[model samples]
Each structure stands twice: as C-alpha cells, then as structure tokens.
Target: MTSLFRPDVEALAGYTPGEQPQESGWVKLNTNENPYPPSPQVVAAIKQALEGRLNVYPDPLGRKFCQAAADVYGVDPDWILPANGSDENLTILVRAFADKNDLIAYPYPSYVLYETLAEIQGTRRARLQLNGDWSWDLQRNRPLIEQAKLLFLPNPNSPSGNSWSLDCIQKLVPPNGVLVHDEAYGDFAANPHRMELLRSEVGSQVVVTKTLSKSYSLAGLRFGFCIAQPDMIRGMRKVKDSYNCDMIALAAAEAALLDQDWMLANRNKILNTRAQLASELSESGFDVVPSDANFVWATHPVLKHQTIYEELKARKVLIRFMQFPGGIEPCDRYPDGKLDGLRITVGTDEEIQSLLKTLRVVIEDSPST
Candidate 1:
C-alpha cells in the first residue's frame, strides 16, 4: 500500500510527555503540576457551566474568557487569544508563520516541544544552543535570530528553571521575526508578566503564551492563552480553531484568573517548598541552580543523573531526568561533560519529604554512585 503521510511525518519522532502512571500511591513529580486545588470559585463556575451548556457549541471567540483574562492580565481583550492549551498556541504559531521552507528557531535545551512542533510543520529548525550557565551567545546566534520566522523562548527555561534578564530578553528580539515568550512557569517567578514590552513599540514583534496548568491547578482542564499586540493576535486568531476552548474550560479558566488571591497563595507555597528542596538537594551533593520556577534542576556531583532518577522511580517516586540531544558546549561552570539533572517538581511538604527520604536511601544504597 502507498503511504499517505509526508516523508517528514514518517521520520519525525513525536513529543513524549512525562510518565503518567495509571495507578495511585506514586509520588508523581515528573510533570510540574500544581499540587494544590484550584480556587473554590473554579469548582462553582464549572458546576454552573455543566448545567445545560453541553448541548450547544461554545462561543467561537471565547469572548467572556478573553475579557476576564484581559482584566486579570491588564491587557485589552483583543490582545489575547485563548486556546485549548499553551501547546495549541505553539502549534498555531508555527502554522501561522512558518512552512516547509521557512525557518523556526528557539533556544535549545529549554523546551523540547518547540523542536517537535517545528518538525510537525515540516519547517526548517534551528537550535540556539545555551551555554553551560544557561546563557546564550547572542553574537554567534545573531544570523539565525534574524533569519528565523519565529523564535520560541521558555522564560525561566524548563529542565533548568533559570530566568534571563529583561535586557537579555530585549537583545533577543529579531528585526524581521517574532519572539514568543513561553511563560508556562512564569506564575512562580518574582516577575512573571512582561506587560511593558507587550505594550511598547517593539511589542509588535513579541507574543507571550501562558497556561492555567501550573499556577491555577487546572492541568486537567485544557486552557491557555497568548498575549500580543492586537494586530498580531488577530493574525494568529485566524490560524486557531474557531471554538478552541469548550464552555467548561472557559468557565474554569475565567474563574481561576478572577480569583487571583487563591493563585497567589498557592504560588507562595510552591516557591517556599522549592527553596527547601533546592537546599536539601545541594546538601546531598547535587549542583542546584537557583530557580525562579516551581521546580529545581540539580546535577549530582558523584552519582549519575540517570541512576538517581531510576532509583527514585523504583521506590515509587517520580522526577524528571533530562538530557539535550546535542550536549551543551562545556564552559568553566560545567567542567565535566555529559551534564544532566533531576528536575524535581515542588509538591506538598509531605510529598517532597517522602521523595527526599526515598532519594536519600537510594543514594546510600548505591556505593558506586
């Protein structure tokens, strides 16, 4: 039989999400999900939406949710386009801007999904490699930056959870391309929103995508949105699904954004736990990076990163062990090659304590480590 799929599609490796065990009793932390429950209002709104709402198609534009998000994020309703999730936003961006011949560039080792999404579009992809300290060589990458049609940056990058400065971010703006700030973990940072840049003259080239999964405790509810200039939003809007978000999700997302206090309280708790977790990991001979996100990236000085992840998993604890396909260029900070880390999500105090206990035992048992 003749193959119908494109050659690239046949060769492409789809993105692999973190392990989602079917059973319970697992200290699941591989995915960075909010351990706390969403705002009480979210539940009430969802219940209300369930009443006689399923029969009809949702608002094609998701107007109500857009207005609510606008109010919360202090942006105009037209400047935001709500989506099923941030992943959907990324897909739409690729579709809207790049094609098989065009180039899509992004900082490597930040979000692997960027690579997968670009590949799915059958577009040319460029990896702007990060240095050992998670910093970029702007001069070296300037040609790609200018040539790319889209550049995706996960602020407070994943697997590292380190944030670059505003000046550094500004330097990344392309003269002819769009810069996307994937602020998935922005809620846990001291300075999350970049409203000023979005409102500035250069705002025309910047797009910011956010999600409810991490901070709003709505990972189960697929809801996210992107903020950009009204013109850019309008352009991307045409690329998105007519009714990208369902009624239930719109209700939940609106309620979640409106209840800012609830989100803030949960964020504070996670930040605190993150601090403690990083300290403990450091004490255990791990090289912990100072993080602004809800998770810590720590490489062990003695034990192998994979060994730690496997041992912890055997004991029913889950944490992320990630290595970039192309190893990062070694710098003074990272002298030893093949640097990888355990990306542990900051869960509840009890859950984290249990993970630590098991991890300590695993380390002690591994004399070879």
Candidate 2:
C-alpha cells in the first residue's frame, strides 16, 4: 500500500512533550508548568466570559488581548499578534516566512519543536551546535546564520536552562532574514535578552514571542503573543487561523495581564525555589548548570542518568531526563557512559522540600562515584 502523507512528514519524528501522568499522589514536576494557581482576576474573568458568550466566535484578531499586551509591553496594538499559544506563533512564523526550499536555522538542544516545524514544512534546517559551555559563539555559527531564512533563538534556552547574552544575539541578526527571539522563560531570568533593539530603526528584522504559560501560571489557558514591527505582525496575521484565540483565553489573558503584580509575586517565589534547588543539587555532587529559567539542568558525577530517572519515577517524584540522541548533546556522556542530563522544574516550597528529601534518598542508595 502506498502512504498518503508527505515524504518529509512520513520520515520525521514528532515532538515528544513531557509526560503528564494520570495517576494522583505523584509529585509532578517533569513539565515546566507553574505550581501556583493563576490570579483571582483570571478566574473571575473566565467565569464572566462563560456567562455571556458561548455561541459567538471570538474576535478573529484578538483585539483585546493585543491591546492588553501592547499596554504591558509599551508597544502599539498594531505591533502585537495574539495566538492560541506560543506554539501557534511558531507555526505562523514558519508558514509566513519560509518556503520549502528555504533554510530554517535554530540552535540544537534548544527547542525540539523548531526542527519539527521545519520538517512539517519540508524545509531544510541548519542545526547549529552550541559551544561546550552551552553558549552561542557567533563566529563559529556564521555559516548557518548567513544561510538561514528564518532563525529561532530561545532566551534561557530549554533543556540546558542557560541563556545567550544580548551581545551574542546582536552578532547573529541576519542582514535580510527574520530573527525570532523566543522568550518563553524570560520572566524567570534576571536580565533576559529582550531584543529591544528590534523596536529601534534596526529592529524591523526581528520578532519577540512570549507566553502566559510559565510566569503567569496559565499553561492550560493556551495564550501567547509576539511583538514585532507592524509590517511583520500584519504578515503573520494573514497566515494565522481565522479564530486562533478563543473568548475564554482572551478574557483570561487580559485579566492576567491586568494583574501582573499577582504574577510577579508568584514569579519571585519560583525564582527563590529555583535558587534553592540549584544550590542543593550542586552540594549533592551534581554539576548543576546555573539556570536563568524556572528549572535547573544538572548531571550527577556517579549515577547513570537513566538509573536516577527511573529511581525518581519509581519513588513517585517525576522529573525530566533529557536523552535526545542527535538533538540535545548529553552532558554526562563519557567513552562508555549512560545518557546523563536532568531538567527539574521548580515547584512550590513544600513540593521542593519533598523532591529534595526523595532525591537525597535516591543518591544515598546509589553506589559512589
């Protein structure tokens, strides 16, 4: 029988999201979701939206959400493009800018979705490897940067939980290509590279994408937006789904934006927890990467990565063990080594304490390095 799918789709592997275990009583910290609940304003606004509008389609352009984002970010509403989520924004970007023959460039071991999107579009990709220290080196990556039509750079990049400096970013700005500064975890970092230079006369080539998932504690809400020049926003809007954002999401996001103080309070707590987790893991003989995101990426000196991951899972404390063969470079691989890298999301203080206690026991039970 002949396959009906595109050849690229047939051969490509889909993105694997973090496991969401159904069973209760498990310490779920594998996914980078905020442990705290969303603001009261969000809940109230959602309830209000439910009471009035279920039959009508939401504003196709998400005017209110764009306005709210504009006010918060100090941009004109025409510069904001709201989406179902940041993931949708990624899709829109791929469709809006790149053709099947164009090259899409992104850092390897960053976001897996960028590669998947390119594959779906049947576009070629230039997977640039990070330096041994997991930082971007512009001189080394100039070839890929020059060839790319669309470039995705994630600040406080995922899996590694480290960031590229603004100076590093400036060197990679393409002379005639689109640069997407994916800032999904920017709020957690102290000095996130916002690419505010794009807002200046030299910024027409860049777009900064953000989400309500992490800092705002609204992962389930599925709301995100991008900031760019009005021309870029208009181009993306033309390629987006007719009614990308629903009424409930719009109301909830607007309310959440209005109550940024509540979100900031929760952000501070998560930052504090992240600091403590990193410190504790470092003291426990793990080579913990200093993270600017809400999670800590660490590798143990002795234990095999899979062994520790299984032990934690069996003990009902779930954390992410990254083992992407050709995607993310394993931090713990030796001549004959087990895949070794852990990305642990920072939870509430009580949950962090529980995780620390369980981790200590797991390490103690294992053989010494």
Candidate 3:
C-alpha cells in the first residue's frame, strides 16, 4: 500500500535527541541539562497553578510569561512570542518563511535539527561550513547566504560549545533572509543578550529564539520563546498554535524569569565545573575547545572518541559521542572528510570528579598506544 505521508516525511530520519537512560546510578551527562534544580519560586508557582486551573484552556498568548520575559530582556511584551520550546520557534520560522525547495542555510555541524526541520518542509539547505576553528567563512559562503530564506545558527553551538563573535554573527545575516539566532545555551555565555540587534535598523530581519531548558533548569517543562520586532512577532503568532504553551509551563517560565538569582547561582556553579572539566580533559591528553556553554567539546589524542565514550558509559558515565559523516564543508585547518568528537555536559562537582577518574581509567587502560 502507498503511504499517505509526504515523501520527505516518509523518507526523513527524524532528529535523534540525546539519550535518556532509565536505569539509575548512571552519571547522565549526554543531554545539556542544568545540574541544579529550579528555584523555590518556580516550584511554588507550579503548585499554585496545579491548585488553580487544570480544566480551562491556557492563555493562547501566554501573556504573563511574555510580560515577565519582556521585563527581564528589556523588550516589549508584544515583541516576545512564547512557545512549547525554542524548537517550536524554529519550526514556525521554517513554516513562516521557507516554502518547499526554498533555500534554508545554517552553519554545518551546528544544530542538526535545522536540517531535519528543512527536510520536513522539503526546503533546500546550504551548510555554511565553519573554518576548522569553528569560525564562519563569510566570504566563502556569501552566495549561499544570498540565497537562503531562513538561517538557523546556534550560539555556543552544540557538540562544539564555541560561540561565534557578534561581529561575525552580524556579517552572516543574509541580506534577504530571516536569521534565527538559536541561543539555547546563551545563559551560560559571558555575552548572552543580543536584543540590541533588534533595536538596530536591520532588526526586522532577525529573530532570536531562546529555551528555558538549559539555564532556567526547566528542561522537563518544555517552555521557551522567540524575540523579534513586534510586527514579525505578530506574524509568527499567527503561524503558531493557539495555545502552544500550557498553564503549568507558563507559570514555571514566568517564575523562572523572575527568579534570576537562582538561575545565576546554577549558572555560576556550572561554569566553575565546566572549567574544571575542560582542564581535566586537557591534562588527560584531550584537546578541549574553549567552551562558552555548559559543556565541553573535546577529542582524545590517543583513543578514538567513540572508544572513550563507550568505556565511560560502561562504567556508568554517559556522554554524547558525535560525528558529522558528510555534507559538512571542511576548511584548510581541518582538511578532513568527516569530524567526530565528544560533548560532555557540565554536571555537579562530584560528577565531574567521577568523570575525570573514569576517564583516566579509560585512557590508562586503553590497548591503543
């Protein structure tokens, strides 16, 4: 029997999320989840929402959370559009701008979801390959950018943890495209907010999407939002579901934004642990990327990353082992056909110590010389 689904949908290998192990005692660091719990305020707010409303429909606009985000980010409530997750914002961006076969470009080896989203929409993708240092080759990719209708770039990119400079970001904005700045790890970076770009004359063409999953310690809640000019926000609002974010999520988001101190406390702890993790990897004969996010991207000098990952997992430690098989544009510094590395999430101090201890064992015990 013939399938009713679209051909691309039928053929697509949907995005594979980070592994979630159900068993206990595993130091789960594959996913970039905040090590600390959310604020007491967030807990209290959820409890209140549970006692108040579960039957009625949630606010389609999520105005309360919008207003809180606006206050925190110095943007107007109308300029913010809340969603179930920042991933939804990406879907909406593709739906709003790109048509089937329309050009959607993004930095290669960044977030693979952008490609998955484009595939779902049957849009063309021009991978803006990073020079081996993880910097954009604006001159080389200019033509691709010129043709792109939507561009999704993750700041402090996943699996790399390298943040592109603001000047670089400005230069990569497609002249006739909507640049979706996917800042999922922005809260952990030194320079997080890019809202000033929205105030500039060229603001209309830029859309910044954020997720509470990382910094706000709300990964389980599935809440996030996008920031753009009011007009652009209105257009996106029309494209989104009537109530994409539920009542509990809205309550949590609002509370999380208002409790900045708690988030900062966690952010600081993660940053400290991240530094220690990177240094430990470096001292253990691994080349570590200078990370601006809550994780570190590194490669072992002697052992294959896959081997290291497997050994670590065997000892009840889980981390992401990633590979870009092909379709990634290479650079002179790394004139390779493919790239692979490890992305280890920043966990608690004890977790880091366990990771380092186990990593040492993996390295010392390796049969490879």
Q: Evaluated with lDDT, which candidate comes out highest?
A: 1
Give me candidate 2's TM-score against the actual structure: 0.95
Per-residue lDDT tens digits for candidate 1, residues 1-369, read 777988878788654656989899999898999999999999999999988559899998989999998898788899889999998999999999997888899897778889888888889999998888888899889999888888998998988899988778888888888999989999988887589778766789999999999999999998889999899999998898898899999989999999999999999999999988989988888888899898999887667789888989988999998886677768764665455778999999999999889998998887554
Q: lDDT tens string, model 2, 112-228?
A: 889989989989898887755677767778988988899999988988888787767777777668889999999998886664657655589899999999999988889998999
Candidate with the larger lDDT of 2 and 3: 3
Model 3 global lDDT (CA atoms, 0 to 1) = 0.87
Candidate 2: worst 10 consecutive residues by lDDT? Answer: 328-337
Q: List candidate 1 stretches off by more than 4 Å.
A: 14-17, 367-369
Write down the lDDT of every candidate, Cα atoms only: 0.88, 0.85, 0.87
What is the TM-score of candidate 3? 0.96
Between prediction 1 and prediction 2, the one with superior TM-score is 1
Best by TM-score: 1
Ranking by lDDT: 1, 3, 2
